[model samples]
Target: MNFLIADSFTSALARLTGQEQKQTKTAAFDLQLNPAQPGLQMHRLTNSRDPNFWSVRVNQDIRIIVHKTEASFMLAYVDHHDKAYSWADRRRIEAHPRTGAIQIVEVHERIEDTGPLFANLTVEPDAAPAQPASPPIFADLSEDALLDIGTPSDWISDILTWSEERYFQMSDRLPAEVAEALLEYAATGRLRSPELVPANPLEHPDTLRRVQTVATEDELRMALDFPWDKWSVFLHPSQREVVDADFSGPARVTGTAGTGKTIVALHRAARAVREDADARVLLTSFSRPLANALRAKLAILLADDPAKLGRVSIASFEDAASELFQLMTGRRPTFAPDDALQAAVERAIADLGYTDLAPRFVMAEWRQIVDAWNLVDLTSYAGVPRIGRRNRLGSKQREALWPVFEAMRAALAARGLVTRAQLFASVEAEFKAREEKPFTHVIVDEAQDLGVAELGMIGALASGPNALFFAGDLGQRIFQLPFSWLALGVDVRGRSSSLRINYRTSRQIREAADQLLPQKVRDVDGVEDDRTGAQSVFEGPPPTIIECADKADETRKVADYLRSAVEAGISPAEIGVFARSNDYLSRSRAAVAAAGLEGRQLTERAEDFGNCVSIGTMHLAKGLEFKAVVVMACDDEALPLQSRVDEATDEDELKEVFETERHLFYVACTRARDRLHISGVQPVSDFVADMALK
Candidate 1:
């Protein structure tokens, strides 16, 4: 008989202690090896609604809930003896009638009525009697419309009169697709149509998501790991469609923070490797840490087949490009630092007699137009379309500016050092000259942060119709100015999808962090993030915004908060302190020190801090998570950093500065899972004021 492990079992298993978990795994392995062994005691649960439900003895107190039939034995749930029996008693394994998908649903009769809507109310004898409560908002929807979406038959009448609170309490009892649709309808007054009926119930896409047939120990281990990462084992119907889709050209998946954009990208990479025998997949992200996380998750997903895992590669975008550059040039490229490049521009301008123009403006032109598009000569630089450059330049201005850019290019050539953009340009040229590209498919996570030249290099590496796929959130873009992807030959205009379910953050944190942005955020390519439709899976305490009289006062308050959190059972490693720039990290460390705890500075390679609190800039905090986060030193001029604002040469550059700063704050605040603390001096940055935290 086949052995299967359900997500419900893992959810229950995660609660057991180390010893208890180990005993439970031993019981599970035995069951998988031989279900009918006489040494194992299995008793049919008389109180369960489903006849197949049985309880297997794990120890004196712990029990495992198993659903057994002639064909298979499925591990459904596990807990202490009483709780395990109660769980099986309330739930039944069955195939949905209309959608024909297998689901473990709660028995309707087992649920208790939520007594009265309001408690402790008194009615006067003289007052008129209250009318019966009105029907639910969806009462007008036809039964056919409701059933089409997979709503259970027995619960339909209750749903017609159920309040929103009652619905939330019983939502897990319904099929996932139906519950998601009903929640959306309650939040926004619009109902969506249901999916078409599938040809087979057991083989339906939605059914395959929750019900997996495990025939070996490897599959059981995969199921056990699902509670911590449900997205990898169980894909939502919407997310599965995106992963399995066959796109004609480059495609993108966009959503707000916590939505499973990264999940889709990782699964897509795996799917390509599994389906195509000759496919070479490259899974990359914006930073080394995130790419490392991706690699770890990939191992869990593909553990059953090590051969397929060998076919996939994981790396940061820059690392991958640098490796490919070395392969082509036979020498490592020494990139010119930002300051050195700017100095080259200054020296070139002073020597070429264009000292009248602001050095800032000349540098901006070089970055946005000259370097970004790989303009090699004055002729190419003269006609390059400055996509987001607000200042208009006529022929006289172009003629005058070309010489400064050309001079800077010449200076870099003389030093034998190349800029990052120039390096990507060289890599792209090499890819075009080769008969075979390094990767057959390139899946990019955090694609929104890629610069123009990087996108061009990616396009050159995998330019087939189904060669490239990108996943990122537009609101989380902390680096690289906004540029048109279409102009660089990677257009995802018609083939983009947005994920709306947030699995990482709490509702309070998500809402408060959203206040820092407008209702809608759109990239230069006209793709918009559907922020309104996004919702968190859980709720937490609203953030506390602390305003102090001075820096010392703020630091003291922050230290007290940290100590209190630790006293309340949060470990030091679970807490993170961040600032707008490295300039304010000293204050962050001081707060940690005052709290009587050491702070570990988070770096690109250092992720685990053991028992020390992590301190870093907002940029470094990207792709990391914590139980709580403290955004320190939001002083009047620190966040927007007076120097950056003072150096803006035009309206476009200044606008980009503010946008990136706001995104930085949002990213830092959302990294928190439960509590978020935003502290600043009395005259705080304007963004803190916008948070309106209570």
Candidate 2:
């Protein structure tokens, strides 16, 4: 008989107490080894809707529910003895007739409460005049069309009676494919036909995600050790194409927040290494902390095979460039401090007799244009398109500025120091001079944050037909300015795709955060990415937004939120608290302290956060998620980052400060999987206000 594990088992297992979970896993492992073991004390369930349902003793009170057939033994659910039996009584495993996918359908006939199921939604009858009732969401769909999306046979009447808002409240009861399909059709006016039935019903696309055939002890062990059912190995149907497709040239996958871009990147890297035994893959991102998280998840994804993990190297873009530079030159690259660079710029301006240029303009021009592009001579500086600069420079000004930049570069070199731009340039040059590439594949996460010099090095590192792939959301482009990837020789024009189904965040949280960005975001290369018609698989309560009178009140409110989240069963380690910057971290820290829970500050190098509520700046919250999140200190000046706006020399620079700042807040807000709380001093940030008004 084939032994299988259902997603429901893992989800139920996660909620058990530690001691109970330990005992349950032991029982499960033994059952997998020998389902007929006499010591398991298996019993046939008398009340179950599915005759195959049976109970295996986990402990005196806890029970492991299993479904047994002549050819298959599947772990189905687990809980206290009575609750476990109750769950089995209300559910039955069967292949969906239309989609040919296996689903555990709820036995609604056994449910006693039909009043809640048919509750009518209402408007405020006391204050406002009576409004016309909106039409039911699925009233127009024929029964055949309803069955085509995998809706259970008995739930057709319940669905057709649901209005738009009412459907959202009860959508989770339907099968995932049904809810997703109906949601997509309602939101975008696009309907997908039912999947074709495969010969092996288990091979159906939906079955592949919901149910798995465990062929070995190791696979079951890994499955049990994973965090939750949501993190199952199966990719969403949309992500499967991007992960498996072969790109003729450089490729990219873009999406909004929580759309599983990083997951696709990791799978693509693993796929490359698996397809070729000699492949050397480097999975990378823009920051150290995010890279560490990726490495940990990659280890779990590839834990079944040590050799596959050995073929992949993980690093941040900075670390990768630095390692290459040191390897080629036999010495570590030394970087000039920002203060020293500023001093050099000051001296250069004085020496070049240019007194009119503002320091902001001079610095931005040198960093974004000269150093970033490796402009070595006056001609290159003269021809560079300063795309984002609002203040255009004349020929005379360009000539005058080039000499100052030259003097500053010479001064930095005299001190045996280099800028990040210089280090990557040297690495790029070394990569070009070599006949053999360092890695066969380069997969970049958070690719939107990559800088010019980093891209230059990456362009050289990933030159093969399938060598380069980028994964990121344009809305999450917080670090880098927009640039032309085609001009840099990494063209994704024909090979780009955007993911629309979000797996990480809740529908409520996603919609709130989406308000902070434009509906359509275009890149400098004229690649337009639409944020429209995005959908989340699950629903959550609307984010809690509040305004406080003072720092003390803000701290109290945030502390209350933390306690409430904990009381609601969200563990401390699964919670995160963030502020705009380190300057405001003390307030969040105090709130965590007041809540009587440990708080670990996330630094650039933080990896193991232990069992503490994570506290950090919003910037460090990238690529990290939690069950609950608290974003505080959103006082007007703290959020748009007053210092940046104050430093902006032109309208363009000022606009950039707001855009990126909003993106930063959006990133922090969407990091919560289920719950989010935003509190600030009186006069909250404009971004917070946008969430409510928009």
Candidate 3:
């Protein structure tokens, strides 16, 4: 008989104690190995509404509920003996009548209280009489229309009585297609069905998503090992398309905060290496910590195949470029310090007799235009396109600025020091001379944060049609200014996809974070990031925003919240505290210390955060998640720090400063999953009030 495991079983198994889980796993393996063995005590339950329900004894008190048929045995639920029986009695497994997809549905029965029907229900003299129940949200739709989306037969009538809360609570029990469709309708006020419904619903993309068919002992054991991580084993149809699609050139996957972009990048890299014996793939991100996390997930993904694991290399963009530069040049690239570069620019300006030009504007021009494009001569500098740079420089201005940049470049080269951008340029040039690229496929996670030089190098490194893939969210773009990929020769237009289902964050938190951006955010290159239909699968209490009287008051409140989060079962490692800048880093650390939990400052490659709450700047909070998050020290000067604002010399620079600051807040706040507590001193940043309204 076929052995099927449902998401419900995995979730229940995750809650079992360590010893109980071990015993239950052994029982599960035995059942899969030989279901008819007499030593395995399986009892048919007469109390269950479905005749197929049976309980398998795991221990003296634990029971495994199984729905058995002649052709298949489904491990449906698990709990203590009585609770397991009660769960089985309240549910029945069957193939949906119209869609033909299998579903385990709650039995439809009404319990009548023996006590007088209205016995404790006294009506107040001023109260009106009770009204009849309301109908389902989509009651006007035809039965065929409903069934085509895989709505269960038994749930049809009861759906008419389900309130919004009830519908949300019961969503996990419904077929994924049905739940997703209903959620989409609820979110957009429009009912949408698939363009082509599958004839065999059991084999439909939606049906096979969360339910896996375990055919071997090893497969079952692997599934049990990571019981709660179903996303690792099963890919959503939306995610699978991005992972498996072939592109003529570079391609990208974009979504909001928690939409599984990283997972797709990891799986795409794995698949490329697995399918081609000679293929080498690089799975990369912008930061070392995030790259490490991706490596860990990739290890789990390729654990069964050593060859695939060996074929994939993982690194951050900086590390990858540095290694390539060192490999070709026989020396690591050293970067000139920012102070030295600025001083060089000062001397260059003095030598060029451009005293009228503002030093800030000249520096911006050097960094964003001349240095970014590696313009070697005055003519190229005068003609280079200033994409996102705000201050427009005429030919005279460019002529005056080019010499300063030239002198600065000469100074840095004289010291044998190169900026990261220069290193990337060197690496790209070295790879261009080779016939074969370093890696056959390159998958970039958190691609939104990559700089222009890094993008140019990545584009140069991938020489094949299906070599480049990126996964990121435009709403989380904080570090880099907007630029056209077409100009860089890495255009993802017509090859872009968006994921709508958010898996890492709760509905309340996602919604609040999303309000920071427009419904549709477009890049300067005209790539539209449409987030209209995105929805979270889970719900939680809305994030709490409090404005305290002072720093001490905010710290006290934040500490209390942190302690409460721990009391509510969030481990210290699962909590993160953040501030807008390093100015407030001490305050965050103090709050964590006051709460009696050790706090560890986060770094680019910090993995040893043992039993301590993480404290870091908002910039470092990217690509991380927490059960609870505290974003404190939101005084106006702290967030959107006055220094960045003061440094803006043009309209575009000011706008960029404000937008990136808001994105910073969005990234930090959305890192929370179940609970979020944002505290600040009175006169909190305007962004805090905006989030409160959301």
Candidate 4:
């Protein structure tokens, strides 16, 4: 007899029943018939909690208890455990009548349950029912009797509550050991001492001891009286709030570049580990550099404490997922999207009936089909009408087309036709399976560059309410793709708190940068232009609008800027020149070399530099801040505005691209902490004239 593989269940079900069911109902797929194999164990899953819902293993000795009812099958409600059923357990089982005919079997001895396994064991009839309808064991006990019970000293309930409230703004429900310890402390009016508390609270301790005392008005003054020290760095109110709040939901912190987002995130992790002890906290970043930066920062912050270091895991998101995927699947995942497979899908769509649609349009059309296969609501596409004819596809047509597209996508995805979206989804599923609980609070930096699919993946990591924090600048988006946080499902239209005070740049520099994009400037809180009695040394002949003859002249002018800036007080490393195209960077690098001035072109594989002139394309400069920046070589084709174009193409698309470029330029200008130099040839990008001295 052949053993059934869990991977092939969906296709097998579709073949057997002649009906294509969605894979979202995984519980249903697990419960259906077992491909008619003889001598199979048919291990009926018994309820450790609810006895009515049962599951059986095919050709294996695994068992699971059904919890939820699906269209084709039941969902596993409880893991297999040795605990006997109680009164509450029986009611849950009796609530849902078992629908399909499944074989039932009884096993007396409990198997050696090892690893992080969930089981539902069968209870003997003679031995009590899996769950009994008995009164509470302590129901008859009087308040006096409860009070008289011997309790341990060192009750840290108040401390636990205080600590949780400080950071997460919530309370932690005490476990049995902690509750008992708290009870004893309450009766004794004194803690048993910090040493008596369990070493591992995340695994064993039910309560936490809040040792950090809140500073009163007088105490705060007294603390502030001391001379500045390293501890002074840890005393900011914002940092205090992060350290105190008991994060129960996602939180987003939007601040300027130096406003301490990373610092707050690092402190939050440390606080979580020090306070909870038993809980595991993961600090992850999108890039390896950021992750390594965070790890190094955290190491310095958490130095001299061995226990605190053990509880925190710092890694990049890709690294974490890649490791887990390798461990569980026995292979590393190749995350490249299958363009050839997508092409095949496009061809299939055209051959099947879609005549006028391109491959990308066909892919969009098939989105509905994929949604149906995933068991998502078909009505989600109510406003999006079907392709072909103005009659508009009805709900019925959507339902009809869903299975075909979903099947195709799934088959392609399995064969590696996965997109970034599919890759994120798989990683989320893997993370959920591996992690016991969602993070308390997740803080993300550079969130403005995140795509919609990436945002969805971030949402998945935050399990409880209020667990997300994001900080980003819309003006800094340089990606060819839109970084519309709103499009990624973030609401930015509402009245959100803003940080406006520019502290990093001088008022003269800020004023000059603002002049470069007059219309886009908006008021921000705390931003002030405080340049009293000081001349603007940074101010120059209003951005040199040089008229270069061709690309060769453009490169020569850029090389000139690099040499001039270096001759001044600015170090070679302090100066960065940006362009709109990579070809320009390549050509500019050669020109700089010919000019006999040291220059390096930035690339993904480039290493860090201490003091070398840097050249890069605009897109590579997002999320980076520099001391001084030189933007060069803007022209008609590179920075076209709507008024320059004569064709009747999509005006909305043009406007969107224009606005993004404007913001990108704004971001580039703002990167300069002290000085900004911009130069472009004649017929300069229309944006330059729009805000320049006319």
User: Which number leads on lDDT?
Assistant: 2
> In terms of lDDT, which candidate is stronger, 1 or 2?
2
The 10-residue segment of model 2 with minimum total lDDT is 227-236
Q: Write the per-residue lDDT of candidate 1 for residues 1-694, one digit (tens) a residue.
A: 7676776788688767768988999998899888888767999999888999999999999999999988668888999988999999888887677777767887776456566954656856857777767556777767776777777777677777777656656776777767777776776767766656677555666666666777778777666655543344557656777999999999999878777788898889889989999999989887897888788788877877889989988988788888888888798888888988889988988898765878888888888888989998767766777766898888788888787777788888888899888988999888877778888999999988998888988888876867999998888887788878878788898999988777678778888998888778777778777788777656677898998898899889999999998987677888999998888899899999999998999887836576799999998888777888999999889887778889888888889888888888898998898889999887899999888744
Regions of candidate 4 where Cα sits further than 4 Å from its true position: 1-248, 255-281, 284-330, 363-408, 429-435, 438-440, 464-466, 478-497, 508-547, 640-654, 690-694
- Candidate 2 local lDDT, 535-629, one digit each (tens): 88888999999999999999888999999999998889899999999899999999999999999998888567767999999989998889999
Q: After superposition, how far is residue 245 of candidate 4 from its true place, in Å?
A: 5.8
Report how far residue 151 has shifted in candidate 1, in Å: 3.0
Per-model TM values vs. the true structure: 0.86, 0.94, 0.88, 0.52
Regarding TM-score, does 1 or 2 come out ahead? 2
Clashes (N, CA, C under 3 Å) per candidate: 0, 0, 0, 37
> Over all chains combined, what TM-score does candidate 1 have?
0.86
User: Which tens-of-lDDT digit does each residue in 265-310 have in candidate 3?
Assistant: 9889889988899998888888888888888778778867877888
lDDT of 4 by residue, 76-192 (tens): 222222221221133232110111111111221224557455445564567644653433223333333332221111212223333211311111122222233333333344333
